[model samples]
Target: MSEHNTHIEEHRDDEASKLGMWLFIFTELLLFGGLFLVYSIFRLQYPANFHESSLELSVTIGVINTIALLFSSMTIAFAVTAVQKKNNKLALRMIGITLLMALVFLVNKYFEWGHKFEHGLYPGSDLMQLLERGHHLYFSLYFFMTGLHALHIIVGMILLIIVYFKVKNGSIHHEKYVFMENGALYWHLVDLIWIFLFPLLYLIS
Candidate 1:
């Protein structure tokens, strides 16, 4: 009877934790949705300017980042699967890979942003120079929106690191894997955001 009581308590705790994570995720979506609405309104107001600004972006770099995020998403999915199967070693390795990929994506973003700065194309900086030459409002939105998304990726990586340690120490097992699953879900959302950002910012031309 005591063992059954303990099991019930554990299940209750797990469900509560999962609920909290989902709530947190919902809030994040709303925040990002607000930004998306702003972008849409601005794009409609200045369609030509936005298109011209987007031309300054490096499609090649954007493609590379997309591929990296996709690979990281795959790694996280496999990590969750490994944990479900009770394969701790494999799960650890998968998490490590995902972290590395996230780092690579950030590094690429650093260079991309640096290049923009060198060319005098950042938000609210030398706007006259770009606008006088041609339309640049699109590029302004591009940098701000995508830059915010990159920040989210960094935050997601930090969460993944925490989950990695928990799984390594047996805090996350098949019976108590909600934390890992939620973490993976968040990471996938980050990847999904980038997927949409890439096409909208790069390929729409």
Candidate 2:
């Protein structure tokens, strides 16, 4: 009887934790959505400069990072599915692939930003001093939005690392995968944000 009650309690806890994660995700959506609204308002106020700054960005790198993030999202989804099916090996591989892809995206971002620095486009640079206010505002938004999103990606990777260790230790298996699911959900959110960000900050430019 005690064992049965413990099982029931565990199930309830899983449900509660999942609900909590969803609430957190909703909060994240609102946070990014508000930033998007700001971006739109500023873009409207400085359409030409925004377009020009957008054009200066490397579409190639943006597209590549987009592809990398999308692929990572898929791998993490597969990892979650694998864990649900009790296929531990496949789950670990999928998570590893997801991590690798995330690293690739970050490396590309590093080079892209470095290229910008080489051209002296960062805030407070002499180049920025020469540019119009609209350009400054555009780059400011660009840095803030992308930097924040990148920070999320790093955080997601850290969470995945913890999940990976849990899986290794048999703590996150088919019968107890709520944590894995939450991690995957967070990663998917990261990918979703990049989807919107790429087009808005790169293609539209």
The C-alpha TM-scores of every prediction are: 0.87, 0.93
| CA lDDT of every candidate | 0.83, 0.92
For candidate 2, the per-residue lDDT at 62 reads 93
Segments of candidate 2 deviating more than 4 angstroms: 1-12
Superposed by TM-score, candidate 2 places the C-alpha of residue 205 at a distance from the truth, in angstroms, of 3.5
Residue-level lDDT of model 1, residues 1-205, one tens digit each, is 5655654443347677778888988887787778678777877887777777778778899899999999999999999999989898999999999999999999999999998788776777865454743255566567777888888898899999999999988999988888898899889889977877888778775
Q: Summing lDDT over every window of 10 consecutive residues in candidate 1, give the lowest-scoring window.
A: 3-12
lDDT of model 2 at position 94: 98
The candidate that wins on lDDT is 2
